[model samples]
Target: MQWNVQELENWEELRTYVDTALLPLYLYRPEKPVKEHVQRMSYLVQVAASIEQRLKGRVLMFPLCYQIGDEPLAQRLPAGFAHYVLLQFSGDRLDAHEGEGSRLRLTVGDEDLESALRFEVTIDVLSQEIIRHWQHGGRQ
Candidate 1:
């Protein structure tokens, strides 16, 4: 997965990564009704659209809408897929490293991040980076 120091070179690559890596992860929402896919997609759109604003000049965002098959990757999609609809980032890469779970090497910096919350909020509560910063004590 080694990300060469090239993503930050321009906006095109940033969009390319999102198209290639993020879209397959959750595009269709297999659990939802066909009619609901549009609503689901709209929600995903709002989330994905925010990255550029939050990150400012640090990262560029890809498209919010992508079409994907309505099934899990292991059963229908295949291996090494984008896994659905996902927002992607591209920027100047620093280097590559062994990732936490997969064999794919990842580049350093925000460009390498693949947080799906950029597309939805369900997992946001558990993100360690967020939790660590947000957790607080009450009258304990």
Candidate 2:
């Protein structure tokens, strides 16, 4: 969990690795229910783990993070819906001033995602598992 200046300087490169790693998860979208959400998240984790191995210098993958109330409706309604996609960097490394550092607001959504609200709701439920693993260290 050490980030040296040299590695930090190449912030764009680092961010690319981050983006490249997570993009796939959202591209295709996953199956129903939140259980499969982890598969998508695993895509992001795999990216970070891969980057951690090849890159040298400073750079740490903090821990997975997700928020329960990114959307007002989801929070207030308390009904079934897709939750927000949480973006947890290894301690906000994505916020770096590098070229295009990690997305300021991290969200894992598929590229060809349906242009509908329900799809979003689906992503939310599964997000809980992502947060759980980051905090407790286990699969969904």
Q: Quick one: best lDDT, which candidate? A: 2
Residues 2-110, candidate 1, lDDT per residue (tens digit)? 1234544564544434322222123453565876655555544444444233433322333443435543333222133221222312221122222221222111123
Candidate with top TM-score is 1
Whole-model lDDT per candidate: 0.32, 0.35
Tens digits of per-residue lDDT for model 2 on 14-107?
Answer: 5533322121112222334565556545655554444344432222443343333222212121122122223432222222112222222343
Error of 2 at 69 (Å): 4.8
